[model samples]
Target chain A: MIAAAEPIEPAPSAGAPIDEAEALRRLRQNEDQSAQYYAAWWLGRMRSRNPEAITLLCQALGQRQPRQAEAGVEHNAVARNAARALGKLGQAEAIPHLLQALDDPDDGLREAAARSLGELRAMEAVPVLCTRLASGPDVAGAPQTASSRLQEPCEAMLEALGEIGLAEPRLLAVIESFVAHERPLIRSAACRALLQLTDDSHWGQQLLALLEHPQLQVRRAALMDLGAAGWRPALEPIRRTLAENSLKLMALRGLVENPAGPHATRLDEETTALLAVMDELL
Target chain B: MLSPNPMAAEPTELIRALRQADSPMGLLLATRQLAEACHPGAAPSLVEVLGFNNPGAAVAAVDGLIALGEQAVEPLLANLDDHNYGARAWAVRALAGIGDVRGLELLESALACDIGPSVRRAAARGLGQLRLDALPRSEQTRLRQRCLDALLAGGGDGEWVVRYAVAVGLEQLLLGMDRAEPGHRSGLKALQELAGEPGDDTPVVRLRAGLALSRLAGGAGG
Candidate 1:
């Protein structure tokens, strides 16, 4: 009995265990630069874990930075992280601050904002993402210390909206425009996003047409999407493009998944033939 | 030959280990092996690894990030400026494999600055693989020039495989240009003459001369 001493109570879960109000107050008043940074970050993280905290952060994000504003609020890694947290939280209220962040001169800040807008799945941000995509990567200012990678966040944002399966007309229009962007990578991303959105009618046909995109990647993505949609029309054209082993493998895989028996058999034959070529090359 | 099946008896252990792996390489190898076997559970862990501390480890985490292919692009792109050329090269190669072009501009930059000729060559091949040649003439020229310069720099002593690669790239550049421009004309002619006598002297010289011929032919065609 003595050895069995009462079991200790389990520690509180990380979620909402402490006094949120107290923490927020402390976070608001902490004068230490790093402390303020951590506070803002935790606030954002907490907001992400619980939607209730979103409105509060939204208001705080909207408030003008203190007199040290030029020091750059969002550039603070914490602020950037917070913006990303808000993006994950997906509250519409965070849109404006996130958009303002898009204009922030800091590439990191702008990127964080772009990523958050995407995670929120806010279709309203579609126009902004499109504009940025069109602008391409920021190559000016600050001796260009940063690489062109900041543009990936906006690309992610675009993908997020597509993956959310939102059917907003403007969103679709923006996605369509991206498909033709001067940046091949952006166009490829747009194609992938469009694939995420499978509208059996219009979107499906457009994706099917992309089978002919000059870029093999766009074509591969389109074929994959068509397969995902179980579109039968993809069989013939996909069969024709079997020149590429990778693409052919994808087309064959799609046929196997979707079940066009005769078409699948044909693909199997082509696949086998392609394997012979590949084996010889290998 | 490891398997990827999640329903296997040791699946739970593997999954747990995957979540805690310290290095991305370990995580990637385990996940890839698990995937080959039959386990789909490695996906999330793989995706999580993309956010790892080391850029190389982060890149190793990519093949398993299909759940967020597009989502992973930016993180991967950000790594292109990594202090270690290997890390930057790995990131560029991975983005190209992801083949989304979201990082094409970044890759284009890498083709110019990254130290190793192999890395630059990979970037060039990736652009061609992605058909970025179809981009505007200006962008195309930039990409082509980088590829040409890299092919020429790689040297003829490397390997026939490398030599063949340089020749292919020279051909690609010749085929990619507007053909009417003076630059294109000079480049194609230089490439054709180089390709004429395939006897390997210095791979760099042969490649460079071949690339010039290709550009010359391209310009003449235009």
Candidate 2:
């Protein structure tokens, strides 16, 4: 499905990369939450497919230890990071555990699980994502504090659905509802879902129009969504947008690199136009 | 209650050029003109063109029939070619697009097992958007339930497109409902299950279903 949401990598691995044995060793030593978190991030960032590494992360996903509670919100960074690691590991075995994490009480873990599910392109996660979205405050008349629902995984879930593509009309109906959302980011995400569902230029144009939004978050969201959509038609519009040039270049690279794969440096017409645009950005 | 094989007789001389046309361009030209004629005489020749083995001409003929609306339904039903799968599929598309109540049975069975995913998809969508406003409110309610039942059953279709179409049809059917009515909840519940059907692997279907859910969730009735 148009290459699962451009695997957003975790922040550059803490210090240098570690050997698999060392990474596994750090992940197992749960006495220090910081070490375990970095190790989890490292395992995923390094794309470690080792069975033991996967098993450790799957186990970590269930251990919501070292809860970082603030303002009545509880989060286990290690478990959240572990969920992210498992998604990058690319194993069918992690799917069941990820689905379980989806129901975890920790909002952070659920968001992480949703992101990973999209990265893994787990089709089974669609219903779980739908259920989560359906039950969220975004539902009409649901008791809502913008801040509380903002922390929810609606964006990740929407991105996951977009990566998964249209499976059911009911699921699609849910996505369509976000178009009229009071928040711009959610609306941007809905447009991304539509692009993946239909690959139509109309959605690309919808995202492009978001560039005019007064909010930077909404504009940035549109830029990123446009990149994830890989809408070649948006290349020129991205250039014309008032955002920072670096952001424009990054979005362009995402569109060009994604379709042809990272190793594709061929000098085709599309690439030549991209090079020209890149030159202008520079 | 319609003539058997409406195309069996000589196609009226009105479309003599269409009958004589052998080249693709010639056929297309003839068909395009006849499709735009808006004359009752054009209906019979258009029905006859369904079997002509030219897709472009057949598309034009279908458009002509759809333009003729209810007047063309009987002729379309009568001219159904049991031997021509292509023609039959096209007929289903025409009937679906026409939204004639007379095509209801055909639409139901087609959605159930039309062999062609495209045909089933068309039937599923057609069933959802079928015009029932002219019927008495009680009749509309009964027929809507029937339409909902068919859509829910079609949701399990093995082909993702058909399943996706079923989701779309369900959305259309639900949106048209009077929320205060007794059946709206059942329809909404059906849509909720569709969005998250266990073991459903097709994301496109799920995506459409989620959109349907979101749209409903926003409304007072939802």
Candidate 3:
């Protein structure tokens, strides 16, 4: 027994285990700004399933630190990183924090929050996101940064609502209201959101009608949405649009999105001709 | 004066205003609004504005055209020969993003022979976007092999930026390949060699190579 003196158990290492708590601490309060960024990135990269990581990320989402200039662009790295981490984590618990972050002063942070909300598919955020889509920044006293002036947050909000895909009547109504918004970009975003909201043939038909919209942008958006939604009824219309040389590429894309092989019998002479042309061009 | 809050206007009303814009400045401003609107119907207007002298308006127009997807491809192709380098640059970029085979020929040519680094860079990225996965397996292998060869050749490009683009293109090609396919091994071998080479290769190229290698080894399809 003495000869085989028990191999001494390895001494408990003095180095603190690099665990979630430590990562969270570094992400939250690390003096080295780069370390903070790295920590936030690492948490998402590792796909840490820990609840505390979610909580820390949510808390960090609201934090507005001194603006850092990155590649000549001013932004809050911490909030941006935190919002991105939360989106990657896809934790439901982080939704409220992300929703709150939609109103953050920094446009980048707001965009990041809106994007994260979409990632979580937080249907509850639809109303708030719609409001953000309909209105620019809500804070009266906040300084208008370049991003706010550019209305980037509005784009982010619209995209978020689309990604949520609640398709609730209220949400659809809100999005529909924006379809008529003056900004073609916003209108385009609205079309995308509507397509996301419903697979209804009726909705598809409605989008088809927009193919004749006077603005090329509107027609373009309709073609894109119809294709994305795979609205089979629109195939004929898209084929008709494809007859126009300028619009042919888009219409062909729509037709391709809903291939006619399954419904070959339904193809009219014109559609068949257009399909042949599409085969050549595509 | 253009209304300060264009967001409040209806889509139809906004289109009317964009059409009615009298001066280049006014058209530029309205075009900026339409670009932000993200509607494909704006493609024609945006494409027209792509020829505008104002850098900001041209930039916005380029973005809108790119956003319009295939709708912008033909129009952008029509403008590919525009005298303005900026217009050509933006048109190439939009066409490249659309990734149609129509754009593929020009992009491949540009990546292989363009005098301008920016054009080469855009072409490289455009090559990566060409949905090889959608093609038949034989076509996929053939096209990917061609692309991989082009990218490897581009790795020796004079500009680090172009080399970086090559790395990105290689990653895209590797991603679209079926792991079980024999073609994948060659693509993997190229990326691994690039990753292993530290001399002269920029950090970005090396990083992308390492990532592509890891993705391939991990059996994660791009």
Give the number of the best model, judged by TM-score. 2
lDDT, candidate 3, A37-142, per-residue tens:
6567668755799887887777766655676455332367767888888888978888878878877767778878887788788988887776655443333212
Where is model 2 chain A poorest over a 10-residue stretch in terms of lDDT? A1-10
Range of the 10 consecutive residues with the lowest summed lDDT in candidate 3 chain B: B1-10
Q: Which stretches of candidate 3 lie over 4 Å from their true place?
A: A1-29, A34-56, A66-75, A103-108, A130-152, A200-282, B1-222
Model 3 RMSD vs true structure: 17.7
What would you estimate as the lDDT of candidate 2? 0.72
- Predicted candidate 2 versus true structure: per-residue lDDT over A109-167, tens digit per residue: 88789889888889999988887676443563133465545545677778888887655
- Shares of reference contacts reproduced by the candidates, in order, are 0.00, 0.00, 0.00
On TM-score, the stronger of 1 and 2 is: 2
Which candidate leads the pack in DockQ? 3
How much TM-score does chain B earn in each model? 0.50, 0.84, 0.74
Ranking by DockQ: 3, 1, 2
> Which ten-residue region of model 1 chain A has the weakest summed lDDT?
A1-10
Q: Which prediction has more favorable DockQ, 1 or 2? A: 1
Best candidate per lDDT, number?
2
Give the winner by DockQ: 1 or 3. Answer: 3
Q: Categorize the docking of model 3.
A: incorrect
